[model samples]
Target: MPNMLLGAFPIGTKSGANNSTSNNKNGKCKFLLLCGGYILFLILGAAMFSAIEAPKIDAISKRVQSFRKQFLQSNACLNDEDLEEFLKAVITANDRGISPLRNATNEMNWSFGQAFFFSSTVITTIGYGRVTPLSQTGKIFCIIYAAIGIPLTLVLLSAMVERLLVPARWLLGTFNSKLGHLYQPFNIRLLHLSAIVFIVITLFFAIPTAVFAYIEPTWGALDAFYYCFISLTTIGLGDYIPGDGVSVDNRSMYKIFISGYLICGLIAMMFMLTIFYDIPQLNLGQLFTESTNGETEKLHLSSNNTTCYSGPSGLYMPQRDEDTRRAIVRIRPHGDDSPSPDEAPSSLNSGIRVP
Candidate 1:
């Protein structure tokens, strides 16, 4: 009779054990494929970027070499030794406002206006490095300033982003009201993200690129766009800066205005990134985590009871009241009629007992 009962109730095998294993394997495969596809996309992007930029870089190099050859040939007085001496003089003259030539007015570097711009850049973590603090005292002050400034800047930007999210959420809600019935939530999210991206590109990138190209004679539209991208991304490659190559009458004011532009652009970028990360479907961080049985875990809450599940998946699954009660009853002692204070209420209608 015991053998028959044992045979009737299976002990080792589960109902959906094979299906669960298969789903996990499929999820892992999908994750790997997603990763591989992303890697390939990056590789292709890099290749295309190199293909477009390489010729321009090569042309610039050739022009530089040609200019150097002509300069050396044209100047009968400047031999290799004289060139070395001239470069040394130029280096020494840097930040000192002294001209390497016989008679020239000192460049107004480290002026109050320029210093203010530099401080703004440092606080924003832009650090273009085109103009840097040279003196020991200045360096020490910069260290102290940045130590205090970085966090303050972050707090300010975060507050600004939080405020901006009101309009952003309004736009999302509008999109949902118009299209939610027709499309999935993920599609609506993408549409919202695309709209934000459009706004950012139009305001920060396209208009700025046009303005920069118009103001800076040496910078074409592409160069201006590249500069904007680098600066907004905080890459600060320092290869291209505004109001630096040209001799503008109000250089200090130009620097101050550009500083304001950088700050605004950074704020817009931060807001866009915050919105992007809020969408779970697009978050890349999930790739590194373990996969579950093909279903994404969702949370459910009740007024009186709470239950959670855990496994290799690192996902949170909700349990029904009946399931919760059964689990608790199965685990508790057979004679124990009442649950302990730590135990969650069996049903949403039941009141949670206090100790």
Candidate 2:
């Protein structure tokens, strides 16, 4: 009788297990259906948005093409008299402070250096208006080229700034040590940064601004300041340009000077950013977001614990997360195969697996 009861227990447990499995399967199906519905809704919304925006984009494109056609029409290649008239119109526009609608062109075969400078100016958003890309192919290429070139310029600027900060970091430490007793670390660092800013402004900003204001036939202090602000911000509106201020014999020298100004001003800005980072409060911009906060904590841990922290005094390293490491291991099975570099060993598993 006892053996029969034991057999009945197995049947009872099997029934319970099957019921639980059916319940779980139903739950999963419901969840999957809900997820699929949400995704479909999102896709529909995006399609609607694109459909609405399409006409506006098409209209703008059509207008641009129409203007391009007018500009590139063979009549645009004017004789000397016509050219003179055109230039005078441009100059007159400058004098009267009236900007005519710009048209496209269909002329290529510019000097390599000219093309390079033009590309740089456009990518930097400076649009100096000294030279512009001509030709339908050139304009199309210009759009694509600027897309890539601007990002490249940003990366180059970032790298240059990183390199420049080496000295700035040392200077910060020196100042901190000197003023440790008298001021907080943040205050001392700010003082050090101010000194650097004073030097940079004296040479790069104030001096250049004054000189440009005095020489530029039409530029006042406000115009000069605006130019400085615009250029430094990389707005490159091509409206208020530097060379337009003066009629110099040596255009090459003027361009070289402007290039130097750009480089120095960028370096100064990076120095200011270094000081900004020294303040723990403002520096939190990188770590303030929910996603980045996790990244920040990981960085803090790694920097505090590892040799990466000791490389330089002011080099900021982030903390690492064991939770993320474990999550990766859970997703990938580690039964027989070696784990990937990113995957951590689970506590339940004994062997140290390598990928």
Candidate 3:
């Protein structure tokens, strides 16, 4: 037998101290580069976002300023400072989904349906920041509620992901059977993931996009698709919401259904992520982490006349050369004539040497 194990083993201490030190240095360098790259990525995202969004922010600021000036002009008695304070309060209220104007026709934000939507979003970590607790009591309750509910939501979603994985694995198996000989396993797995992606996009994204675009007055195709992606990814930008318009019929039902859609869509998103993470080669964590020693201390003993039996390794076991019948051996004390089925065999004759 060889002194080392091979075939897909981790980094072992087979090399010298110099090689280990070099590998440690390389790992440190890789880690530092990863940190630098991540910071650069963040900066890049910030720069691009500023470039793309600054114009819209300026336009909104201008519109709000114009509205403020117009309001002051119409209400001649109200001074600029007074209107500013009033507008601040109105903005605060609006931030919490409380409309200051009397033109509102929808149900109150705390109504059962809206509250249900808020709770679901909160637990799922998809908080849109659109509706929020105004009172200290409600805020405290929200903290407590989230503390208890988030884990429950994760447990529920994780169960769904696990159940979904069975079918996903089965699909991968089917793909392997059909194309295993023609393509590599990685390629076949990619094809399986692609098929699942297509199905998820069709059912959760494409169909919902069409439905939402049809029903939502302001949403175009791009907006609907964008909303689905953002919400399912738990981004929850709060820029747009379905079934929020005053003209929406049966708005409560709509909100409830939208909440359900968000939950289901989130599950589908998690399922895809699970599939992606299942592919070890695609995992990025391995790039950032270093392996420890994986070698085991092995001892082997052999003698010419002694029989030997090697134990099992995984599914592979040493085959038996001969079969031994399983027969019960019973022993009792010499003075005991009655049958003693519970007596151990060692009581009659001590251990026997095989060699």
Candidate 4:
């Protein structure tokens, strides 16, 4: 009977020891599976995007080649030495003076307003490349300025977004109050996200596109919309830029205003992204976490020393002092030499005892 009692006491301990090793192995397996899944998804997505874009890319390449061949064959000036010399003279003229494409008025590219605009673009990572620093001194200044400015801009944007979250959460709370009884929490959260997305798109994309179209003579609605999308997304393709083709009445002021618009639009986009990520259903990262029930069980077991077992009522109960007494009585033998209840072995004491 003593041997049986001793054997039963170690059962929980042995299970716990086995569980620790199994938990570690399970965690490692989960990590590897997640990594492999991510790699596979990335490869599949790349292949899918390439397949979708390849036909248009090939068509554009063929058209560009044909245009180049036709232009070279049709133009007799290409075969003339005098024309070639003229081209060389034009290149040399660019070295002496500002490129005609940059500022036809011969105004300095390093003017304070233009420099400020350039700095904003660089720090924001827009890099339009329309007007670049031409001198060695200017290039060196740009490098130093960007290194400091990028972090400062990031901090400013993050602070602004953090404050913005106050109203965002309030908006979510309002939605919950209105819809909580009728809908699941996930659905209500999705609706809240949609509201933010709509506001961001209207304020940043739609309104800016309209304003840009009205201001820039060359840009139509579609062109302005595309420019706004590309700029805010930080793609910065540099193909279609405002205030570049034809000189306006106040070009420097226009550039500065565009820079301001870019900064605000980026902030709005960041806010939208933050709200989107806050919705756990949309976040793929939640997949890597353990289930809620399993996590709860692990946390409970780790914090308490008492063993859990089924009681007479078929409910699981932690083995506290009262349960320890019952276990001792069951394990006691019928011999007269057996110890009384009060003289039971100290090893049979509760694992967790209140003081």
Candidate 5:
């Protein structure tokens, strides 16, 4: 009997090994295909963007050259070469946030407030490109500073988002109580997220847009709004920056306030994204990575007792939820469509709940 069992075990083990190897091959193939598709997507985006904008760039360059010629012709005192050299000097200085124009009222780039603002933009990854390190030493320092600071900033934001999630979850609860019966859980969750998004826009984007437009002499309403949107998205297009407009009193203080605004606005934007990702239906990641047993990719966040936005598998929440106030919905058992009343609908079904 022992010999027969051993013989059977060998065959079974070999079959299981074959299955494991086959699964691994499939996973690798899927990963490679996904990567190839991503690269193609990037190429497609680049082509489209260039097609739309390359002509505009060419036209701008031609216009700039024409202007340079006009300027050289008008000013007889400065020859072409001399004017070119002077303009190059001014342009170089301008790129480093230094104003070479005699009448320019812009603050010095390395002044205490302006330097602090630049540092803020660096760590926040909102590299506006309006000011930049030119020296080799400064550039190297920037590389190291960003490498260390970006992750630290993300960690800080994660902790802030975790605590901020508490109130957001409570807001979900309020919605659930008010409209849990009238609509499906998913709809209520959508409305809840929408409400929070509206509030966030009002607080971080809309109000700030109004103030920036009011204070920034050269910026119209649209420009101020565009700046707010770009800054919050961290695109930092650099076309417009706060306190960089025409003469303004206390411009240094204005830059400092703008730096603080970026910090708070980013935190609020992250909180909004957290809420959006909390909805499992919106997790496009599940489509790519769900497994046969219904599990998918998972991440564990142990530090600060905080959790990231778990894509599709489960709550980033720990096995035992330590915080009662956090409204996390857990996945129900596979093949068990009917849940007991005590179980209530897990986060999977409702996308939100107390237990």
Candidate 6:
């Protein structure tokens, strides 16, 4: 009995150890899943908010605009007689109660405002339903128009980005090659990222901001910068709009010019994002994925950063060393009981050494 008990002790101890380790792993996995679920929830909530909030704000803004126009017209005649008449007319109208809602026809004078709005929608890809093409021909044409124009705009932006990426990649390489010994790979990548950000601010933001301020009436430097910032981000509040300076005789030409400006500006901003992606460190979260491998991993982030795992080889490198990090991954036996480095056995005893 004593001998039997002695032999069983290690087995029982190992079994308990295994259970503990398994529980730890399961706990980790559960925590990760919960975190992922929370992130997904936030993303969905944000998208829903954006879809609903924008149109509601736009409706409120239109109402405010109408009220402002009425106020200005009333204030135009401040003298006693005209003021009294205007006040009486406003009082009578208020008593009768103006329609709280406007039909599409009533907002015709605000069409130019909606053009600025359409420009914003185009950039953001939001295309809300409140204002739309009234004529059948216009409606049919709009569908075909967006299909072609959106892709063409994307292509133009992508091509420009490709061109810009070459120089950006080269610059990063030069910095890495020269200062590699002085810093960790991540540090070098950070320096390179800073350079790109500096260029983006100087070329796309500051200069354009200055030019816009000079050209547009009612725009100071801050307002111009705000317009450029909002338009580039595709927020497009549609307030502080431009190109209203042209006389009524040249309205069509003015509209065309404004349309061209918005499109070109939007494309240029997209190209800036492309240039930003050329920096590997900034893109680490996005680029980490399952399909990536040893050779491809060496391309940018892999080349500079130290991988933390060695798989079966027991060599610890950078996090990017493993391919498909973002991919849904499952660990299992490779058939011969030979454990892949990624699935090496945990140190705890009694746990099934599946790897």
lDDT of 1 by residue, 1-355 (tens): 1111010112233534665677688777988888899999999999999999999999999997898789999997788788878778898665344445544434456766677778888999988887877779989999999999999999999999999999999999999999999999999999999999999999999999999999887899999999999999998988887866534557678878888999999999999999999999888766545456224332223233544433445333346655554333223334445654445566323333211
Task: Please give the lDDT score at residue 249 for candidate 4.
Answer: 56
lDDT of 5 by residue, 160-224 (tens): 99999998889889989999989999999999889989999999889999998998889989998
Off by over 4 Å in 3: 1-17, 74-77, 100-103, 290-355
User: Candidate 5: worst 10 consecutive residues by lDDT?
Assistant: 1-10
Cα lDDT tens digits, model 2, 279-314, are 776675434243334335546654554312212232
- Summed backbone clashes in each candidate are 0, 14, 0, 0, 2, 13
lDDT at position 152, candidate 2? 84
lDDT of 6 by residue, 1-355 (tens): 1111010112244654565466556656666776798899999999999999999999999997787678767877555576558667865543332222332123332256545556445544544333456569977877777777677767776776778678878987899899999998788877877787677677667987887687765689999888767766766665655543322234434545555656666666675666556556576434333223333444554446432322334223334434333221333333344433444355222222321
TM-score of 4: 0.63
| Tens digits of per-residue lDDT for model 4, 47-148 | 998999999999999997787668668985686566557768877655443555644645445666667777888999998876777789979988999999
lDDT of candidate 3 over 80-164, digit per residue (tens)? 8887798799998777666776766557788888898899899999898889888999999999999999999899999999999
For all predicted structures, in order, the TM-scores are 0.68, 0.51, 0.75, 0.63, 0.72, 0.48
Model 3: which ten-residue window has the lowest total lDDT? 294-303
Error of 4 at 210 (Å): 1.8
The parts of candidate 6 lying over 4 Å away from their true place are 1-132, 245-264, 278-281, 284-355
Instruction: Indicate which candidate wins on lDDT.
Output: 5
Candidate No. with top TM-score: 3
Top-down lDDT ranking? 5, 1, 3, 4, 2, 6
Q: Rank the candidates by TM-score, best first.
A: 3, 5, 1, 4, 2, 6
